[model samples]
Target: MLTFTNMRRVARRAVLFCLGGMILTACSGKHEGAARYRTNCGICHHGGEGMKGEIPPLIGRIDLIAATAEGRHYLADVLLNGLNGPLDIRGVHYNFSMPSFRNRLSDHEIASILTYLAARGDSARPPVFTAEEIAALRAHPLPPSAVADERRRLDGIHRLP
Candidate 1:
């Protein structure tokens, strides 16, 4: 027969084992999400000549966006609903709008993409956009009129090739 002390020890070990398993599962999920971001968003957002003034560079911009609350909000909204019109980042203007991925990606996937971008991009401070924030952006939606206005504004600055 086991003593009370031994029973407590066994229970403690079981708890620890369960916690370890949970941690490993969470880590695996993150790894998979990172891979998905590379396969999807990395195609256009990662690196390259960037369509010659169309798509913005993802790297290094993360810090820039984190510097201001409005910038952070805009970044989250753009990722959730896609951006339309002219976007001026680091002095260069991207005249084309990005398509929304709401139908294709889950909230967690979107959060992972944002997390990757925030970590790897060119911002001075990386900003993480929460899944809740993304869901909220999706709920509100960007107005078509606003998108059209941005498109026209961008057209005035540069022609998309």
Candidate 2:
């Protein structure tokens, strides 16, 4: 014989508990994904430390590169096919070849990395690259027609000191 007041209290408590559980679950998932990035991608990325003149920083340059359509397309292509030579970011030159993860990583893994980068890293606009998108990129690989020339062209853009 529970009163209406007690029922309301129980229901409220149940709702609160459910909400807290959901929040904790979401946080844990994010943490796990970030840890994966550190284990896998961190080898080359290195959080932009000790990579100043080699690899491009993934943190603050997201806004500069992800803001426009061309930049986004370039990023997508790079992820799929990998880019070689020098990349100029905000007047700084990064000379390194970004290797493709197509064969090494699964589509889901790539999607998760992109999602994490877009959500947590610095990007002008958040990206939503799905597993399906990765599949499509794989299906139609970027042509290797002028990769060398493109690299040279990018090098030209770098300010010579």
Candidate 3:
């Protein structure tokens, strides 16, 4: 015993609700990378801000380093193997050991984290790290000191960011 107008009103409301939910899901997908980063890297890096001069901020640093091909590989290697020893970044010296996640996280997870950082940076065209790229770097494992050495070499070559 329902009127046709009443049924149309209910259908319109349902459609609107469905559309709203779709929009929310699309927005959430954009931040999926950030969520992944929070779970894996936010503990120490603190959402790329880092712990002042001790941990090194990734906001400006990561994007700049990733501008070059070699720097991109260095980042993947660091994530896969880890980094240690004294490191100087933006005139700040940090001596700490970053744990390796080679066994803990997959290539896609690592790529997502790096890609998220790159997107956060102020770059005209930010580079995206693919799972394939991460896999290639993962093939070669290095000690923490070696990673540090690579950083030094990269810094010397490009002056870093």
Candidate 4:
């Protein structure tokens, strides 16, 4: 009792529904931080690895430096005021410069970016990075030299809070 046209229409509807479902499923799995990180940080981090050693890799190693509150502050400072000069990352000294995003990105965006990084490096729950924390550093943004100095300080004190 069914016409061929009706059968074709039904088949097309089923196919369209399946396609829509697949698209929705794929989109639902993407993380907000991961997306923003990809847009902003990924250009350099490249999924946590600096391409061809031009930038130091941050994958799986952030926990060592970010274990304490001081370390966290150091990180926020670096993000707020870009880092320049030589850095010894896991024995390999990288002298590449990281530009500051203080002017370009808001404190919240920076926090979101860091949150993504924390999740990546720790594989645990994201750190509680508040805007107040970012604002505290806003009063006097450090230069890359100062950031490097802080890095040295971390090395000296063993990065304790």
Query: Candidate 4: deviation at residue 79, Å?
Result: 0.9
Predicted structure with the largest lDDT when compared to the true one: 3
Q: Model 3 reaches what TM-score against the true structure?
A: 0.81
Range of the 10 consecutive residues with the lowest summed lDDT in candidate 4: 25-34
RMSD of each: 6.0, 4.8, 5.0, 8.1
**Superior by TM-score: candidate 1 or candidate 3:** 3
Candidate 3 lDDT tens digits, 61-160: 7778899999999999888999999988778888878999999899988988888888889998778899999998898999989999999998888798
Taken over the whole model, the C-alpha lDDT of each candidate is: 0.65, 0.63, 0.87, 0.75
After superposition, candidate 4 runs with Cα above 4 Å error: 1-30, 123-126, 159-161
Candidate 2 per-residue lDDT, tens place, 1-161, comes to 89999999999999999999999976765665466567767888875342667666776554344555445445556666777765566566777676777677777677666666656655545665567766876786764334435435443654212
Which lDDT value does model 4 have at 67? Answer: 68
Full ranking by TM-score: 3, 4, 2, 1
Which residue pairs in model 3 clash with each other? none
| Total backbone collisions for each predicted model | 11, 1, 0, 0
Which lDDT tens digits does candidate 4 get at residues 53-145? 478886665655566788879888988999988877766767879988889777877776676667666546546466678888877878889
* lDDT pick, better of 2 and 4: 4
Using TM-score, give the best candidate's number: 3
